[model samples]
Target: MDLPAPDRLAEVLRQRFGLDAFRPGQQAAIEALFAHRRLLCIQPTGYGKSLLYQLPATLLPGLTLVISPLLALVRDQVGQLGARFDIPAASINSDQDDDENARAMAGATEGRVKILFVSPERLDNLEAWRFLLGLPIDLVVVDEAHCISTWGHDFRPSYRQIVRAVRTLAERRPSVRVLGLTATANARTEADIARQLAPDEATPLRVMRAAMDRPNLSLATVEAAGAPAKLAWLERFVAQSPGNGVLYCATRDQTAIVAGYLAQRGLEVAAYHAGLDPAAKRRLQREFLDGRWRAIAATNALGMGIDKSDLRFIVHVDVPGSITAYYQEVGRAGRDGLPARGVLLYDPADRRIQTHFIRSAQPTPEDFERVLAVIAPDADGAWPNLTRIRVRSGLHPTRVTVVLAELREQGHVEKVLIDRKQVYRRVQGTDTPLDLTRYTRQDAVRRAELDAMIRYAEGAVPCLMQALRRALGDDDAPACGRCDRCAPPAWADLPPVEANEGVAGWLLHRDVEIAGSRRPPMSAGLALLDGQLRAPPFIDFMRRRTQPGASLAPAVIDLLRRQLDALARRHTFEAVLPLPSRTWAQRDAVAALAAEHLGVPWGADALAWRDAPDARQGELLNNDQRRQNVRGRMGAALPGATEGALLLLDDYVGSGATLAEAARAVRVAGHGGDVVPLTIAKVRWRLGARGIV
Candidate 1:
């Protein structure tokens, strides 16, 4: 159990990795590892954190086990590292082919692989642990190590098992070194890592923290009147920002809609979400990293394992559910230490959405009861077929396992492995069915966490860096002086708009009352006409123009002239183009108007609107009912708005209706400014271009 020489590690780094010097905090962390002391490295993004452990693995004798939270990263690291070093490296994950896994295990047994990357779930395999116990292991590195903490953005219950597994491994090989690595680790997460990895010995843990400051990243946020305003802000911000970036949407559908909107605007963008095929996601990632695309609109799935160092911006189109998530996502920006940006487009309504998300996440006592019931009986009167237990319990698989873990901790259940699957059995004749009622306190804690997250989203406090510090319980810390709030007010201010002179009289074309068929060109034509005609005049004309048993056709050139004149005065109008509007003269005219006045051109092939089926329309309307419960819960902390026009934005309008309705609510809620409702995408215009019907 001799310690590795420091010069040998340096030589490995130079010869194998072609490096000269350790980054800021890497040397101290590497020294601790060489001395066999437990260490945690809290380095910021793009600081070569991986090399801190990877370099040491090369110097240390025997196999180095790398526990990673992400399979993709493990595979990528093994692929990259194996090419440079003759010492073998292998990763085992669910994605690996059987032959590949067999080869990896063979390499491990042959003492050829210096590093073995595996997901935490793989460690649950008793046979794998048993086999690894026989190996001369030098170090165990936990990648994305923050996931070990319950407070982390991505907490996996399986990670808790690592403590016990490490203890077991230590008994077999008592001199193994343990190291943890992360890009972001607040105080809470750091303590959690220490407790899990080096709980007993005084000063067994050595923590090295790199400064969190990213001076090149400019943070900004837009507080909208409602959803529509947020969408409008996103449109404006993305249009102004330079280079490739990512827009994080809250849902898969929103990702698609935002990406579609940007694409329609002639920007090269792509969408990535769980809904896409894995191959498609890989392609999108490659394209985005290669600069073939200027932007990507995706859900949170886009960030992990995405190692592009030069991503210039990361925009959260919807506020995330937690500060940890927000920090991790925003931290993706400016990784190259060049000027970059992180923008959050938020509105009061977003809190309600997040609240619902949290409420839905509550794991009930019944979930625990069912899991115990399934694992109570097996051929050995033990838990077997864990996957079956998960499926039959009707609980989220992760939740089921978490509850099982709690039961095991309480000494109410025992777990063993038969083959590759987990086997669990309840303590025979134990009447108490894992009483999770005690977890009621945890619920309150979770509620407080949600409240904190909501505050982070809605707080008017300007300094994002300070806000983050406060949220992470580092209050009274000095301000970072680098975030949007700390920046000069003028630099962060929205462009000035003329008072009450809202996008001009473009509201005088004929109001065509649409019915039945869903056609994009027809819908666009209708919106154009509606925009041209004043609301009252349009409604009146629609009522008067409908003739019994007759097609509503009017070849009135004067009507178009009047609409054009109105548009010229204020640049606001609504109209309906005919089907196949590409050939319609008025369609081209509207396209020109949109390009010249509104800063968005109407594409001939773009979808103007979609008609939701009855079921979907009902769902869209139902969302309003759901929203009503949380509508009045938000209170503004900022001073009353100064007299000006305010535009609201949202990602999509399923009924092509909710934005204006929500805008009216915002106005009534004491927004003193003139309100304009907008959306990135509109759907179902058949009811009316502006939802008047």
Candidate 2:
């Protein structure tokens, strides 16, 4: 490896980035990469770690590929590097349309783009892997590299394959340089990252770690007994705080609850979480960065390599999962070297939420079998592509991959490359019984982690900051006199409200979101499905009511009428338009009864079912099949005006196809009514205690 001249490197650094020199560990990282050594750099946040690779990316030849975890991080890096340093950069992410991503791929392929930011998920995506295999990648930088380790606080199974990607890239670029960078990682996590990123028969990865302390941050823990008290402390923090800050929540619901609380108190606040729409996330991120909003109540999703330097305070509504997570989140504040506070509103009850998460993350033997049951063999007794298996399994690709990986480890399944695609097949001549003993052990590991976090939150004798530093392998770390344990704490008293548990009854009167229904092209807002259609009585009711000589009992009829009436009261529908029927042809009797009960006129002729072969929408699988089954099946009846404040009613809704088609019909007829969809039972997935979930 030929190194760049000292003067040349200086000129490139100064002229390109308008910088004089490197941060403490940056130059060494860049030099290590240039030497074709696998590098692991664990520097603190805002340490100009991007320059370690970004500068070299400009001077080096071919493409410098950067794999980042979040779309926001990708956009931020690309935008900054391209604008400030005059480097041609492009990124491929889900936020971009296919054509836009293709253009980015083209730029990388043509060697016009010096650096390309990509999603870590792309490493496992076969199509994306094929595209990258063509590019002569000189350097591969894995940002937020801690995620690569299962022991890592923010472990993602998708990130573990990045080293495999690096090894593949080495086939094209014989001396491809790989660099793993993160802000917070314990010694164990750092070693795991280095081990994962190191290729077979190569020199071990070199670890470069820096101090983990942030002296500017004053840490505190307030014992706000429960959720309501946490919100109460949050109100004062946002109100009294000078500059913009972030309120971190353990879940999306918590973000909404806290953000709503602050917003009602006349503060400009927004919620950022995984559940938010991409456009909404982008908007809130931009506004908060531009200092438009006073604060953002967000889940762990908000702050990453995001460059917000002037944050005044960091508040945690609940205990974080680990010390790494706690340190990383609090490190977000006071990056400008000004004084700021990191406050945790401690509550013991919050441990249950995290414990539940830790338990749920580890899949059971049943999960493995569920995925395996969907696997089909070809004529010669081989399996089909993963996409087919994934479709049949109805699981997320990441989760399916995890289960498959576990099965492979257990020697229950094998992945043989069939025509260049890895198709999985059950191991021949083996008894693959469901064994869940390993997951229990893994669960213990997570439980121990949670317990340690709880100890830190409790602040028993040791300072919270010191406990974090010690956990992250920092020895001789003196007390900074900046924590509640080391110094007198602030905000000892805050108004408390009784913590409410369970679902609120008023939630039934409210409409939540069903954004990506299996039935496509339907505008996406509706009341939550209080229960699943498959639940005992409802399933039995569906069978009996759809029978030829059946009539819905009066009690059942009244119960459904109440549900529709509650929804109708919310939307104030003036008329009821019963969807076209299949089981009971022309007799939407129960729907008419419900409309009469609500004092809304029924539109029998508003839309009629087109004569077609009998097909039950519930029996269909996947959105494509359901959409094809419902297409053009319902249209406005001839010589009838479909206009009013209308409520669409159906006996039972399963893929929502019939209701979707009827709604389309109502719109096509130019109905002047507000169309509110109501149903007796809905096919729901992952129903929670909160009906809206």
Candidate 3:
């Protein structure tokens, strides 16, 4: 099957679209598509992934079905395609009006639309599938195809339904060419796509990848001293960098807070998240794109369909769960082949926040089984329609929808929609009850997958790229030179410190006290104090007490615990604990007490020692040691470096002592540099203050 040449595609590209030439990797993908084979194209951002399907949509006869994960993306593509070409392109999603939808369906049936954009959820409708069956689909393109894979960073349950629809379409039209397009697809995603789409044992699928590297983007990371320090650093970074940038926060509330903070600092900014209304989001996006706004503070929801190419910077106030997500988000910058910066401000405590998020969404085996039992009481009996099932199951409509989808994939049930809602009917059609045990077993498998994902997130391995490779079944793969660990800056290479040398003892003591004395873990205040003492004689004192013959005073422990409790109650410190755990609450009390009484200037030596080669080594250094190191280094390098004028950067601040200490060290270093400790972002210490959740 000889395909057309680059010049031929180029000729078509110009004649129809008035483009000079195909973007890098565009011609190759189009040629592959012309061969009438399934194609997987992995091109970087701004490489014109849409043209791979759009160009073909023009040349190939009949309609082109483009499956997209996002409604905004579909709308954008449709609008762009409709602008130049006379061909009809319509997006069918939940947001469309009834009349618009009817028109779209009619156009598709009449073979009037060249490209029909739809969300995977649209395929859940049996009517839509039947309608699609009537049309002649020249090519079926799945955009953001990585979402179809469970191993992908951003997995949507609805995306799994795509396989079923593809299978249905294949049965109706065997010659339809399937094209999966994505800007980022690692090995796991590629394999998952192939397994779902082309499962024949004899017909193995091949994944074609474009280059992943983008030379224009410069990546950097900074170790936050504490919360205040991190925020301060971010503020300075944004002030120094170009205006067109995005600051990505991990949570919706954080997005708003960061945006507000930046706005207060005299920068024109807006916050964006799924929590906002569609109109507001669109307005904010437009404002930012049109240069009316200088920056945006957003959660993960902002980037999927965003086409802004002149973005100059991207800052992550919190660490992303995986490198894949990090790369995709940061890849939004430097798309125009212009120099841009991708900065990550990180803190060790932020891990707790991410872990909580992961746990919240993890559906247990029990949950799955419960959902299945509601959907399929009698596997052999006729499945009830979606409305009846929804009413009978007593589960939320969304969950019911997902469970039916799972059943369909397992071949235990089939789905059809009556009046727009999905209905799951038993496939076997025997009058026997479904074996609930089978669902339970499947639930266990899903639970294991969730566990693996959590373990992958929490793994201590420094190489993120290697971890991803291993997860994808490539254990011996080389490191991705683009990750934080592989290309760490020279500043990240500090000397190692002993575990017993720094704040470990204080932290252990606080942990033990919180476990024994406090009803809940120590509050944020207590944790701050515990962190502070860990940098000093407290660590040495704990080590001495641990010796076989050493006698420790119970009174001191009691005093520390009381101090921690008071600080927590006073709301001087903030502490976070996930549900199903009480130990953190107890530790919080101890930490609060230590924070109140242990007020001392942190040494620069402590700061440097804490930022040691190994994370464990750094945790061992005392606050004073870190402060001393910072002062010594800065004093020698900067003429005006002084304790009062030095700036310390941290990711989060439960109590402000760490920042205070960093400031004190600058003053003590004999230089006039003001020690201004700043946090990249901060959470509310008081539960009732605002945005605590």
Q: Choose the strongest candidate by lDDT.
A: 2
TM-score of each: 0.66, 0.77, 0.61
Model 3 regions lying over 4 Å from their true place? 84-87, 225-231, 376-402, 411-414, 418-693
- Model 1 misses residue 336 by how many Å? 1.4
lDDT of 2 at 69: 75
| lDDT agreement with native, every candidate | 0.60, 0.71, 0.58
Name the best candidate (by TM-score): 2
RMSD, candidate 3, Å: 17.6
- Which residue segments of model 1 deviate by more than 4 Å? 1-10, 83-87, 125-135, 199-203, 225-232, 274-277, 376-384, 396-398, 415-423, 429-438, 473-476, 489-693
lDDT of 1 by residue, 178-215 (tens): 88888766787788788778846664687877666666
For candidate 2, the lDDT comes to: 0.71
lDDT of 3 by residue, 1-693 (tens): 247676777788898888887677677778877774678877766677888888888877778999886665565567678787665799787657678889998888877789999878777667776777788887888888888876566666688868777777777877777888776566766887878777365765556776666666766666564544555566566776775998888877567556755676687878887756456766787777789877788886776566778899888878776566666787789778897777777666666676554444444445445655655545646456765554454444445555666666666666766456566656665344333453444344445444443443454555554554454445576665655566666324322222232232323333211111111111222222232324443444434432444432455556444543544444422211111111112222332334334332222222322232221112322322223323322222223333222223333343243444343333454444223222212323321111222
Candidate 2 C-alpha lDDT tens digits along 564-625:
65565556666777776756532467667767787867767777866552556545444334
For model 2 the TM-score comes to 0.77
